[model samples]
Target: MTDIAPPSPSSSAEPAHDRQNLIARQPILDDKRAVFGYELFDRSTAAAAHTAASDAALLFNALSYAGSEALVGRKTVFINCTHESLKGPHLELIHPERVVLKVQTLGEQATPEQIGELLPVFESLRARGFRLAFNQEVLRRAYASWLPQAAYIKLDLLAFKPELAEPLIKFARSYSAAALVAEKVETAEQYERMAALGVRLFQGYWFAQPTVIQAQTIRPSQATIVQLINMVRQQASLTEIEELLKKDPTLSFNLLRFINSSGFGLSCEITSFRHAVMILGLKKLFRWAALLLTTSRNTGSPPAVGQTAVVRGRLMELLAAELLQPEDCDNAFVAGVFSLLDVMLGVSLEQAFESVALPQPVVDAVLHGKGVLAPFLELTRACESADEEAFARCAQALHLSNRQVNWAHLQALAWAENLDQDE
Candidate 1:
């Protein structure tokens, strides 16, 4: 969607199904257990009884690339790369230093020459502030070639028989690669063993599990919004707006951070929120902040809950055009955003409605599921539950095409992904 160059790998693997399983990140730490970076990991439950590492690096790279603008505000992200990437469009957009590619040395008999042949690619990347690394198993003999070329390398402590760690550690130290990580180290004894061998980066259940980092909420001071709304519409002077912003220190500080963030690529350095206002003007600024308000409130709602509301809202609007009339889509969109506002805001709909006003019918549908949108909302919920019979009835009743319903599912995912990236 960001005009990424179309990639064609013609991979030996087939198309994947069942994206239900979640992916998590493992912290790449130092010997002191200080946070150094994160290693991306994926699990696939395509079957009930089995799940393991499935190559999700392609999707991970795409999601990370898409989410970088938002995530860059705090930490440096280390995205994983696959064997295919050394030759593709990924190199064009992302630098190597910011990424620690998880490459493997191929077959068991792979030689140092094979790894050395990839140096020209790594050298070009290093010139652009990129970093390279290998993962899991690496041969003792090939270490001479692979170790010299990389900044960091990871080896699973469990993968190597316990006795093999000493030699592996000795081999890793020979080239003095910046770091060697021992992953899947579960117990304190295992950790102590790796640490003694000088494996600084140890990752496993011993550390911590990945969590959905709560995006901080911006509780705009009542006065901040009042002043912003007033000054923005009048197209007030920069000095006057700066004086007004002095009313809310937090708003001013966050506004500066947001403008300076990768999300907004301003050509010149902006030192003040007033300058940000001057650059963006009131209309754009207000819309952006309002969206920030909504996204800040994304909270911990299950993703499927949000996706269903979007599909329901869109479907209802489409139905409105057929059965009701024009001028109804806005109501529908508002309905979608507010459907779970009570849950997201931690207050009943009645209590939350006092803070934000909506058209009566829109509020009715959200609060009581009563109005034209209600029926569509019901249908969307059924599809999410995979209720085939309910979906068929709703599709028939609404005269909606199967393709139309499926298209809405994808659209919802896209919209959520965008909202996620923007946040």
Candidate 2:
């Protein structure tokens, strides 16, 4: 008979309030069309209101919880901030050099005086080694006070007429040393026009859209990951886990790297699998395994897919914790993480499951879509899609409120972002 331990305590606690925000990132490109950096934004609100609380949530989620270093690596991360947010304490948490604060106006019709008043804030930010980005309005003579400290001047191609590009570019060149960035460049012609005008940096869909590349065959390490998860689920002995780890060096390396990562918040470095198991315990070890399963893909899938999987897993785990037994929550997490095995491994769900034995509840939720955990998995997936009716249906079916679902969703996103993809 198989000995299955009871589910471990929930790894995450619910938030005090439902402070939910949808985070999205757009890739900024250079003249050669190579990715330069990402413009992180909040998709929860339609307009870029630039409120202090919204700004704080975006930056806090990115820098503190998301592990900005792991998310963007050494690339500069451009974040939108209000004038008030610039003075807020959130800026203190970031590595100023790695972040470029895109400063926005106080209101839609911000006056020259309003812009002039924040010149000192811009200067102070520059003195602290932080860079500032501004929009085309900074080129106007009325806002001259804020132009000199600009690191980047973003020209909204959609907002400004094409005929105004050269003049604006010339004005910006003469007044500020900031590089011109053409945002919303949606066509090859726009890219060419911008390049001709000496606009070297850009952000838009003209360069490339986000995609998931499917591999024809799975790697050995991927198989080992599946096997390891199975072993952990069955409560395999430490020796067995160690032997499995030894068989796959990639998995072993990733395991150590993940445990030692800044997100894990360990007091001491963990060197071996036995030490990791001893320190993290089987329950926590299972969480790490789920995370590694997504990120350790030697396959050609983009890091975004792995990142998305981690979020799904964590979201399901958190949601399940609300109503299900601890063991069911564990299965819910497995179901969620492995839900995208098809996309990550580039195989059919059945083929992916054939490599290793998984819990039937998880299998039912992912493959058959009929089980106790199936509704949770469905609700988790609906949160990512555009089908609002479906999301509403799924949430209603599960008795999960919008606030409850959104809170869990945001927490999952942050948890996933905190995972370091190093190694």
Candidate 3:
């Protein structure tokens, strides 16, 4: 898991998955208890946890899947980076202004040679508008030479004794340019202690725990999307679809907005529902409506959750493209996207199924996790969760190669990220 911005702090509703890579964001708060930013941590996927490959995947996923607009917006993004990640191509994918590279001091002591090697990299990043964060352990005399580059100093409240907190705070303050952060603070007393030491930034459950929202009530607009999906499945004419959309101004507005979104690739604006229908056609409209079901939420869930659902849908569809008939691909897509309806609609899977008129296969795949599409859904979940064994089994059962699954996973992530950018 990494901090790729999942659900909102108070609404912890997540997409349902048997296996998937978990990405959670822990809020970092300012002195006034306002959200400052987030420190991203990954629990799986990377070889050694903080290796270059994992870091690159996290960064790329964050930028593509969880953009700055969704996560921090204008706030700081504190990402832990190893020495190698500094030189990797993924770092170049994002702008540096809002990112704080938490450079890990490799050893207990930093040699002159190591310092010499890192300073130039630090200088280059700083010159390009990136800030560097350091842990308190970097405060040792052996690593003092790197102190000048520090932007934020993180102090683990759990690691340091209460008495040493003040000394560490004082020492961190001596830098004048660095902000002190007290992380892993779990109690009111710890927060108070850190506050007294002039630590303006804080992280931990003391302020707020990550809320888990299992499901959310579907909005009126979402119900319209369900209606539109039904209409599309029945092969309704443009006039009929347009009439249904016209009934709900909000529905019409969102359809137009989505069609105009960057993902649609339209040169001119689509001002009318009829025009949108003509441009997207029936099949594509069904897909778009399916996507809108999650994205156009009146519920307080994070947008990332909806985007994650979209990724799952795309991944399933991509996996089925080779093995299943062309018509079955649409069912696979619907199954994948609507699989999270139980969570997205705040209802049981059976109850959620009532809203959308889906095929028996799609229904079976989603409700019982049994059907031809079920393994694709499972493999898609495995990709997200990084369940290598499950992924292998599902892929093999479906006669899909490791490279095929990996390629589809990457494409789905890119597709989801592009969808967000289009909006």
TM-score of each: 0.45, 0.47, 0.47
Model 1 error, position 307 (Å): 16
Candidate 1, lDDT over the whole model: 0.54
- Backbone N/Cα/C clashes per model: 5, 0, 9
lDDT of each: 0.54, 0.68, 0.66
Which digits, one per residue and each the tens of the lDDT, describe model 1 over residues 245-342? 43333344345545554334445545444566777655555544432232222223225544444455554555555556554554655565456556
Q: Over all chains combined, what TM-score does candidate 1 have? A: 0.45
Off by over 4 Å in 3: 1-19, 209-423
- Top candidate when judged by lDDT against the true structure: 2
- Give residue 324's lDDT in candidate 2 (0 to 100): 94
Which tens-of-lDDT digit does each residue in 1-423 have in candidate 3?
121211121111112111133345678999998988877665434435556655654544343233223444456677888898798544543557657899878685656787679989988898877899988887877777778888888898887789999888777677547888888889999999889878899998887664321212233344556667777777778888865653343354345444553223345655455677887766556545544453444433234556677778788878899888976886787677677766765568886555333567887888888978888888888888867888789889988899998898899889766642332
Candidate 3 Cα RMSD after full superposition onto the native fold (Å) = 18.6
Ranked by lDDT from best down, the candidates are 2, 3, 1
RMSD of 1: 16.8
- Tell me the alpha-carbon RMSD of every candidate: 16.8, 18.4, 18.6
Residue 30, candidate 1: Cα error in Å is: 3.0
